[model samples]
Structures are given as structure tokens and as C-alpha cells.
Target: MWGSAGIVKPGLERINRLLSFLGHPQRNYLSIQITGTNGKGSTAVLLHNLLNAGGFRPGLFTSPHLVSPEERIRVSGRVYPGQLEKEVRDLGKRFLRRHPSFRKDPPTFFELVTGLALKHFSEEGVEVAVLETGLGGRLDAVTASEPRIVVLTTVSLDHQEFLGANLEEILLEKVAPDRGGCLVAGEVPQYLIRLILMRKRKVGGDLFTTGRDLFVWRNGKGSFDFSVRGEIIEGVSPVKGTGFQAGNALLALAAFSCVAGSVSGKRGERLLKVLEETVIPGRFEVVPGHTTVVLDVGHNLEAVKAFCREAGKLECRGRRVLVFSLMKNRDPLSLLRTWGEVADDIIYVELGEMFHPFRRIREVSSLLGVKVLVAKSLRDALSRGKKIAGSGGCVMVVGSHYLVGEYYRLEGKTADI
Candidate 1:
């Protein structure tokens, strides 16, 4: 639904209708609903791992799949087959036939997918389902499921066209799904922290914010330690990403600690084991080979900055090349400037007419600090980037998720690792 050019009809009405028709499968399992400008996918995966370790049959649903639509739904950390999606589609068609009013006003693609995931989870006998909101909190389809724990990861200025124009407005839109439940918030901008707390106060939920109610810090040697109230889980293996991931890990751990009630002995061991094993694809994911490659689906300015910062941390023997393409609506000037500071070479590929034109980039390429080069396609860009990087260097693919999806499709890669 994210990569498509479909207009977002933000509301719970359609999804609610679909869920009701499906017999409210979401009610059959405990759930954690996560929403944020960034890190939602990674956090959802982490929480799913924790739930698995806690001996629950966890179902994870993330958005903007890298390779297949089925990637959006996973039971016990494994994606459903394409046929399952087909079955869900056929079921929807059958329902529409019975209710001509539904045919007159059909559910959106995301709503259908959300219904599919919930129904699948119910059929799979999931004990808990971790759902990452497809959009802002309140109106997103995932909200229809009604999670017991609601998590808000780092909130930033993105999706202004739909969410809001400024951070405060966007924060309101994100915190609307609190439902006066176990609301956990990650490290948001300092200014928004107070606003989130204020919202929690008004909404009357048990507010748990990182650095306030919960704390996580590096324990040296690429390990982390987190504490909630008085309990502590020490020596958690670092997540496979930039330093920012520690915050995401902490957010997940905090939410899981609430669900599981304690993180000690066997439970602590499970947490540690899951942390070391989980590798979220397209989130600063590194694939090692002749020429090292990094894939990241960071569309907004904050995400781009984090991607560049992580790319800078890599030990590159030769050139550090960046291959990227941004949506037409995004202002690439600042993003380009940030990446230019670290990248030795930058290659721009045109995905379609929907993306920002390479010619538009060429117009201000001189003004930008990076050495910009245009490629005929993603394959061409990756090839040039690998050549520029040589065997000893690195090629980092960043910007939109669509760009990363395009690369995976062209290269026949499922983004394992």
C-alpha cells in the first residue's frame, strides 16, 4: 500500500467494517500497536522477538514490504505465502458479493491487508500480534485492532501532507491511539517529550517514556543495558545498526517488560538471544561480500541523516559511495547536503516519473556539496557504485523504501541479513 500511488483515505470506518465482517479476529490475540515517524518497523520486529522469547505465538505486521506484499504479514517471524494473500483477496471478493453496499464502498488496499493479517493471526493461533501502523496513529487501519500496549517511536517531521505541517500537530496525530492503556514512548525530540507527557496526562494512560520512566545505556563493548523502575536487563547485544538503534531496542524492551512483567533468568536469556539474532532488513542492513553493501529505507530528513551517520561509521578501505533516489514531494537539498558530507561519490537513479527527476537534481548539483552522477537505472547506479567502491570499499543504498525495493527486485535479492 505504501509504494503504491493510492490515495490514503485515513479513518477507522472501513477497517472496522472489514474487521467486523471477519469476526474481529484481532480480539482473539493480545497486540502491541506501534506508530512513529521512524524506527516503527524495527521496534515492531524487536517486540515480536521478545514476545516469541516469552513463549507467545507472536504475529508481526510491517509495511512497505521490500520484495513481496506477503512480507507485510508474518506469523512467528515467518512471512505468509503469496497464496495466503490471494486467498484473503478472494475472501474479500466473496464478502463484497454478499453485501452490495460494500461493493458500492469497498475497503482500501491497506484495510484489506490489515484484515488479512488479523485473520491469519487468528487462524495461526497467535498469542500476541505486533502491528506497525501504516500511517499516523489515530486514523490508521491498524488502530481497528486495538492493542493492549501502544508504542510511539521517535517522532519527526515527515508525512506532513497527510499527518500535519509541524511537529506539534504531527505528535497529536500520533499520540491519539493511546486509548488510556500501557503507552510507551521512545526518545522523541526533547521539545515533544513534554507534549507527549501532557497528552498522556489528558488521555489518562500509564505513560512510560525512555530516559524518564525507563532508561537504556551502552554498557561498552557494543552491548547495552536497560532498566525499568528497579528491574534491569544488562549486557543486551547491540542491535545491527547505527547508535540510534539502542533507543529502539530500549523502547521494545520497555514494552515487552510490561507485557511479560519481568526480565530475569530464562526470560533475560531469551531477550538477549533474540536481540543478537534479529536482523531487520532494509534498516541499515549490511550484506558482506566482495564489495560491502548497506541497504536502508530512510525517506525523511532525520532518517537520511541517521543513514549517513551510520555509513560514516563503517570502516571503508576505498571510496564510500551512495546510491539513492527520493520521492518528488521530498526536498532533497538538505538530505543531499547531509549525505555529501560522508559519501565520496553519489549516484542518482530514476525509478519512475513519480520520483524527483534527475535533471532537477543536475540543475543544483553544482550548489550541492556531493559529486552527483545520474544513472539510467538502479542496476546502472549499483554497478557504478560498486566500481567506484572497488572490492575494499562500501556502497550504501538510501532514501526511499521504493528505491530499496526496486534494488531488491532488480538484483533478485530478498535482502537476507
Candidate 2:
């Protein structure tokens, strides 16, 4: 049947086709939909982990899987048992055959994966499924799920072509319909604020934010400390390398407050336990070394700016070198300009063989007035970047999560020194 072989297409017909084959499983349960320019995956992970810990039996879904396609779905902290993959594949085949017209346009990889997650969730009778949008939120396959709670993490100036150049236009297209409908901690563009005010007059729903509901902060200790809905916990948040994770924790807490009243406390405790156990592979993930290595999956200008500012606050004094790579769709020059200030040198490398590399990493570096070196492979780039940092200088591996994931896989294979 029509699976992930064709060039990517939009519209819900193929998704509907796939779901029908799976017996319309997504409609079986409520879902928490997460959409944003960045941090959507991390936020979804946090919510899924905590909700599962609490006893909600949530099915978690996120995009651009670091390890495998199955990583996209988590049931009580992992993709369901191996036997289910065969079932999903078989079902997808049945789906494409059923819809001859829709089958002409195959479901993209993400759409198929999303379909499988929903199908699995429905089969397991999950309490809720945390669904993260793949890219632009409007027509994304997950939006068809009709989320009960829509969490819009910070909106920023990325995906300009697809999302629009300004916040007002983008928010209208990406995040307004669900206005007052459990809006989480977003960057809150001025126009969005205006649109929200307009929405409130009609009494559609109640919009929420960090200041309006909960608060996040950092204690002197290495762990994150934060206050949520008047409850304070030190080190309750444990996302690595991100100073703003406490903010995300607050966002999750607010989301729970808005909708999780039905969940039992014992189940809530379990969710907290799972959250403590949850680990997103690349967002601000740190690697141990004499000169510490930090990896962040911040590809956009705003996210990179945030990552750099937070990394600077760590006061990493050693020769700080950066391993930079990005996709063709991203703003490479803007990202370079933002990251250039934080590093003594940058080694540019491709995240994968499919990426159309920029021969201009050096030129962007020159434009930004930062030292740059282009390397042929991630191993070579990382090794050279480490050497450049010397004994005390810190090395930052960043730009794309793909680069970080490749390095992580390599790190697992090397014998400990």
C-alpha cells in the first residue's frame, strides 16, 4: 500500500485512509496536542513521562525520532512491545488499498508514524495521548486528532516561509483557533495577545501562561527548582543543558492543572516519577569530559540565542568550541550569527548524508567574525573540536539534533578512557 515512498504531500485524506484501516483508533481517546517552533518534542516528553508516572497510561508521540521510528510512541515510558510493528505495517498496507484515489498520494513517513501511534494508543485503551506536531501546526496530521488540550510552546522567528515572517500572521495560522483553549507558555507575540483579547470577549475558553498560573526558577544547586500552581519543588525539573527547562516544567504543570483533575493522585505521583526518569536525547544534553561537551538541538535563531545565553551563564571558561550543522530549510546565517558569539571556534559538519551542506560555514563565520573550520565527518569534527578546546576549554555540539544523535551513537561505541 502507499507508504513513505512518494515526495511528501499535505491534506488529511491519506491520514484518514490510514486511520480507517486502523479502525479510527485516535478518535477513541482524548489527546494533548503540542505545537511550536521549538521545544515541542521536549515538552511533550515531559508531559508524557509525568502523566504516565501519575497512572494516566498516556501514549506519547513526538517527531524526528533520535533513535528509531518507534521512539515516536511511548507507552508507560517506551514504544509498545515489538509485536505491534508488524501489525501496524500490515494495517497500513490494507489502508492504502482501500482508498484508491488517496493511495495515489502516499502517506509521508511522519503521517504513517503518527497513524501508528494513534492506532497503538487506541488498541491499548490509553487515558490520553500526547501528540507533538511535526512542523507547521495547521494541516499537520496530528491536528486531525482534535486535541482536548493544545499546548503552544514559545513561537519564534523560524520557518519563515511556511509559518510567515511575523508573529501575528503565524499565530493566526498556527495557534489561534484553540484560543482560550488551554494555551500554554508561548513566547506570546503582541498580535497573539491582541487576538487572545478578542477571543476572550466571545468566551471561547480561558488562555493561560506561566505568570498567570505557575512560575519556574533555578536554585543554587545544579538541579532545577521551580514553583508551580503555588507548589514549590527544588530540582523537580531535570532537563539537561537548558536553563529554561524550569519554564517548560512550569508549562507542563499548567497543562496538567487545566485538564488532569480526573487523574488520581497515585497516578500523578507515578507521572512525576516517570518525568524524573524521562530523558530527551539531544535538547541541551551534556557529555562528561575534562572540557565538558554540551549538545543542544536548537536549530532556529531564537532557540540558538536562548541556548547560547544559557550556555554562557554556565561560565564555561575553557576554550569553547562549537560543532555546528543545520538543515537546508533553516536560517543558517542567522543561527551562525547567534552562536558565533559564544564560541572561540566552530567546526561545521553535515548531520547526515542527505543534507545539502553549506560550503559557506566559513563565510558565515567570517561574516559573523568567528573562527570556523569545516570537517568531513562528525567523528573528525568532534575530535578536532575537542582538541581545539584543549584541557580546559569546553566543546559545544549543536545546531541540529541529527548531529548530536550521530555523536551520541558514536560515543556509545568507544571504550571508556
Candidate 3:
């Protein structure tokens, strides 16, 4: 499923069927469902950590694994063991035996994995689950979980082919699972917040929005304070310290404050500790060496723009080199132009079979205003980037999660972040 270049059917029919067969294990625990273009994984991880600090025994499920699928499903910040993984597979086999219709028409890979996560969470006696939607919330498999807390991170122009052509249309599809649950929205435009309230009135829930109900102010470099629900928690910091990550942390903290009621005393201390220690892999993850290397999986225009902003903050003695490749579905013109402003040179490489054509990138290469070079492979790209960056500069590998996974595989490193 990770390697396959196929799209799943857009609806809850298949996942609903699977959940019904499994006796709806999702209802056994409180769930927090997250959906967005960029910050879904980070928010999920943050909320999961907060819930774990509250003694919820939380299970987390996120998509586009960096190196392995095991990174997707976790219990109490640890991957579900291999033995239980086999047990879930056996249970899936039993489901196949019980339902003959599924033989002719099988559920998608994401559906099967979501079912596995839900069932495993139930069997492991998890009290809460944090689920990040694999795609749009209306049709994604995770929506069948019917989460109690719905978190919408910054929704940008991503997966437009499946979600919608415009922002309003995509917003509706992404907010479909909010069935009278506590909805926490990130820093979106005021008009969209009004649209959200208009759509959510049918299924009522108290909406806590950033910049209105929730606010954050910088306390120091890489540290800030969150003011939510008329309470202010001070001296909180996020991993990587990017402006976008602080926004992501604000969304997570807002949702956590909504669920836990108060972010103070022992609970507040535990949550703050979790935030300080949490490290999300492939989100501006820096590996120190003679030439510092940074890995990020920001492919879309909005996400890439955030990455470029963060990259500009890094102090480099030499030139900053960008190592990048994108999926075929993305338009590289805007992303290349954005990267060109921050990076001194760009090395384009093939993302195995999923590589986007170089001709489109070449057509706009002149407009980038930076040197763009093609490499034989990801390894070659990284090597050339390091050489170009020299010993005193930085080499940033960004664009897609597939590229980061390839790097981890080559280095024999586990992406347990």
C-alpha cells in the first residue's frame, strides 16, 4: 500500500463495513481525529503524548510512514508489538472467511490498516486513540472511528484532486466527522471560521479557535506561552522551534485543553514535559555532522513555503543546498520558486518509481533564479548536496516523505519519531 500508486475510493462505506465486522472497536475508547494538509502528524503526536500523560493509555495512528508501517500504530508512544501484529492479521483472515463479498471486492490498504489499529487498540485496552485522517476527513477510513475530539490543523491546497478544487469545498469535506464533538480549529481565516460554525451548527459543539479562544505569545527564543480557556500556561516550547510548528503546537494544546478542561498543576506540568521532549521525525529533523543535514516532508505549496521560511533561519557558513523530489501529482513550479529564494542550489532526484517528470521542473528552472541540478538517485542527490554545502553549510532534504524514508533505509535507521 505504501509503494502502490493507487487511490482509494472516497467514502466511508468500506471502512464502515470493516468496523461493523470488527464489532466497532472504535467505540470502545475515546478518539481524537485529526485532519489537515501539513501538521496532522505533529498534532496527533502531541495530543497522544498529552493523553498519555493524563493516563489514557493512548494509541496513535498516522499515515505515510517514514521507514516502516509499524511507525503508524502506537500504544503509549511505543509501536504495537510484532506478536500483536500477527494476531491482528489472523483476525483479518477470520474476517475474510466470514465475509465472502469482501473476497470479490476487497477493502483498500488504508481501510485494512485502520481496522487493524482500531481492533488492536481495543484488545490492548487503550483508553484513548489519536487518529490522523489518511486523506480528507469526509471519506477517509479513520472517520469511521467517530472521534470525540476533532482537530483541524492548517488546511491548505493539498489533495485537491480528491478533496476539492477550492478552499471552501475542501474545508467542508475535511470537517465532515465533527458530529457534535469538541472541535478545535487552527489559525485559519476568519471567513472560514464563520463557514465552519455555519456548517457545524447542525451538529453542535463548542468551537475553540486559534487567535480567538486560543492564543500564543513568544516567551523566549524557541519557547512560548499558550492562553486557552481563560488560562495561561507559560514557558512551553515545541520541537524544531519553527513558526509553523509553534502553530501546530498551539492547535494540539488547544485541543488538549478542551479535553482536559484545565492545563494547570500536575497535568499541566506533565503536558509541558511531553511537549519539550517530543521529537517528530522528518519535520525539520536535524542530524549533525561535518555538514549538517535536515530532513522534512513538506511537499505542497503551503507546506514548502513554511519549510523555506524555517530554512532561512538556519545560520550557514557556506551555501544552503536543497535536495528535493516530488510526487507526480504536485506542481513543482511554485515549490521550486519558493525553495530558490532560501536555497543557494537545488538537486533534483528521482523518487524511485514515484518520481515526477523533470521536464516540468526544467521548464520553470530559469524562473527559479537558482542553480538546479539533476542527480542519479536520492543518495547521489544527498552526496552532491553535502559536497555543495561543504563542511560549514547545511543540506536540507525536503519535498516528500518517500525521500526521507529512502534516506532512513539507506542509513539503516529506525524512524520511531
Candidate 4:
């Protein structure tokens, strides 16, 4: 939501009302609610994959689909059938029609989608649902379910306009899920970590941190090991990016371990199998071709830094080229400076004018004091980036999810992996 212009009414009353009218489908299944500025989607997907591999019928609810709205909801890594989705939408409309109050004060788009996902999960008889918060944790529609386990991935300074301007305020708003039971967090700053501990203590929740309670370290190529409460899991991570992904994997494993009890050697082996097979789209995904193409949805500064760090690790034969854009509110110059440190050339492309009000290419180029190639469209940008990279080099598409989504739309790619 930070990358787009949307009125974020941060309150749970609307979603609560909608869920109550829909028969509280969320209560019918166990759930894990994940929240953070970044890494929540990847963490949620990883947890979903773990549950599915562990013989549990898991439903996943994520956000900002790369191609279609249906990508937001899935059962066992598969989108719900079109007929099922249509039925749920019709049911939601019928409920709204019957309840004039909802019609008068309409639920937000996210609220409606949350309800639909919960309903579908319930109807599909899922054993557990992994819900990634659409925005800040406290008032996010997903919070209405009161999940059994809560996972907080790295809390950075994004969505400040809606959450807060500073780290303390943002951390406070995002720690709403630290109510009770097990609360797992990534290796965030010490100050934020203290805030999380304080909040968890206030709510009588047990906290498991990446470096403190859970330990994870890279073992070898594409492999990492994690230890929690005297139990250790050595596995190969499918996510190919900065070390941040290993932390994300540990967070997911710790959360699932807490929910499913200790991770035995056999279970750890199963988790590793799932981790090696799972691939999340738009998170440093490598598309095979003559020139390596990496795609990621990293709009914020922290995310951009991670993307660049990971891209630098790739074995590029030629120059590294970048195709990028960001929303109007973000500091495009800072992003450019970070990317410039790793990229040999940059091609700035304008995204959609409505939701994605991307920064002007000329403005960003001037601020950075660097000559950047301006493309008339995403297609042109890709062509130019590939041409610059040549057959031996690599081209990375980064900055906003909108940019990555546009690329997928142009390429007619609907698969998430």
C-alpha cells in the first residue's frame, strides 16, 4: 500500500463487522498471522510450504498479486478454482446486500478480500492458514482472526505515512500480533528488538528471535542450518538472495517449529525438502535466458539494499544493468545511489500513472547526477536493459512490485514460481 495511493483507514471495526456477518470463518481454522515492513510475504509463503509438506492442509493469504487477484489466496500452493472464487464473491455481495449498514459504509478492498479468503479456506477445510498482514499489524484486516502464532519479519521504515514516521512508532503499530502464545521475530535492530520484547511481555507472549532464541548460519552453497531450543535443522534454502533470506527462512522455521512442536530429525528433513522446492515469485527470482534476468519487488531502501547485495553475488559475465522505478513518495535518488554502486548501467521506466505514480526518470537522473537511459515503456526498458547487458551480462528489474507485475503481465506469466 505504501507504493500506491490508498486511504488506509487503520481500524478493525469494518473487518470485524464483515467477518461477523460472514459467520466468522477465520475461527474455523488455525492461523499464523505475519506482519512486518518487509519479508512478510516470503515468510508467509515459506511457512505455508512447510505446513503443506508436514501433511497439513495449509491455506496461504498474501498480497499484491503479480498478475491476478486470485494469486492472493491459495490452498497448498494452488489458487482456488475460478468457479469457487466467483461463488465467494457472489456470496459476499449477497451478504452486503442483505446488510444495508455494510452497503452504506462499505468495507475496504483489503477487508473484502480478507473475508473472501477466510471463507474459502473454511469451505475448503484447510487445517491452517498463513495470513500476511496487508498493512500495519494492529488494524490490518487479518488481525481479526486472533491467530495462534505470530511472526514479525524485519521491521523497517516503510509505510511511514500510515504507520508512523519513526522506528519506535512503527514498531509499536506492527507488534499488534504479539498478543499471546509464540511470537517469532527476525534479527531486527536492538531498539526494535527491545520494543518487541516489551510488547510481548505486556501481552504475556513468548518471544523467539532469530539470533537470540533461534540460530541460523550458512553451511555451504544454497544451504543453511538453524537451531531452536536445542533442536537444530540443517536444510537447503531455495530462496536465492542476500543473507536476509536465510534470516527469513529461520523465522519461518522457528514459527512452524513452535506451532508444530519440536522439529525432529525426520521433520527437519521434510522441512528441508520443502525449502529446497519452494520458490517465491518477485523475490530475487532468476529468469533463465542468454543474459541473466533477476526480478524483485523491492521499493523501500532496506529492500533495495538487499536486492542489490544479492544481485552482486550473481556470477555475471558482462556488465550489470538495472531497470527500475519507484512510487512518487519514495526517495528515488537514494535508491538510484544504492543500485548505482552495483549496477553498470540503469534504465528508468515509468509505471502506470494511476496507482503507481512512479518518479519521473529525468528528476531521478538529475538528482543522482548520472545519465540514465529513459524508456518509453516497460517493454522498451527490458529490450534496452538486455541489449546493454549483452549475452554474458545480467539485467535486474527492481524497485516496485508494480514494475515487476507489469513485466509479468507483458510476458504473459501467471505462475507465482
Which lDDT tens digits does candidate 1 get at residues 373-404? 99978889999999999988999988878888
- What C-alpha lDDT values do all the predictions have? 0.82, 0.69, 0.82, 0.81
By summed lDDT, which 10 consecutive residues of candidate 4 come out lowest?
Answer: 1-10
Residues 1-417, candidate 4: write the lDDT tens digits: 111224466789878888888899999999899988889999999999998888889999998787777888899988966653455466567767777676656666677778889988999999999999989998888999779888888788888888999988988887886678778888789988888777777788678887788888888766677787668876566564345477778888888887788776788888877777667888888887899888999888888888878777888998899988777778777788888988999888876553233446666677788778877688999888888899888989888777888888998987564
Our model 3 lands, by Cα RMSD against the true structure, at 2.2
Better of 1 and 4 by TM-score: 1
In model 2, how large is the Cα lDDT of residue 242? 51
Q: Write the per-residue lDDT of candidate 2 for residues 1-417, one digit (tens) a residue.
A: 434422345567767667777778888987888887777887887787667655578888876655445666777776656554465566556666776565556677667777878978988888888888876676678877777688888776666666688876666556633634566655475666677567556746666665555566666675665555565555554553455565666667667766665222454445444455555677776667677888788887878887887878765656889887877766677888888788888888865544546565666666777767888788998789878888867889897767776776787722110
- What would the per-residue lDDT of candidate 3 be over residues 1-417, giving only the tens digit for each residue? 221314567778767988999899999988999987779998998888888887678899988788877788999988867654455466556667788677666666677788989988999999888999988898889999988889999877778789999889889888888899899898888889999989778899888888889888897665888887778777887774555577877888788776677887778888778777778888888888889888999888888888878788887888799888988878888888888888888889866556776766676787765567898788898888888899889999899888888999988998775
Tell me the TM-score of model 3.
0.94
Q: lDDT of candidate 3 vs native?
A: 0.82
lDDT, candidate 2, at 228? 55
Model 3 clash pairs are none
Q: Once model 1 is optimally superposed onto the true structure by TM-score, how far is the C-alpha of residue 389 displaced, in angstroms?
A: 1.2
Using lDDT as the yardstick, the better of models 1 and 4 is: 1
The TM-scores, one per candidate, come to: 0.94, 0.87, 0.94, 0.93
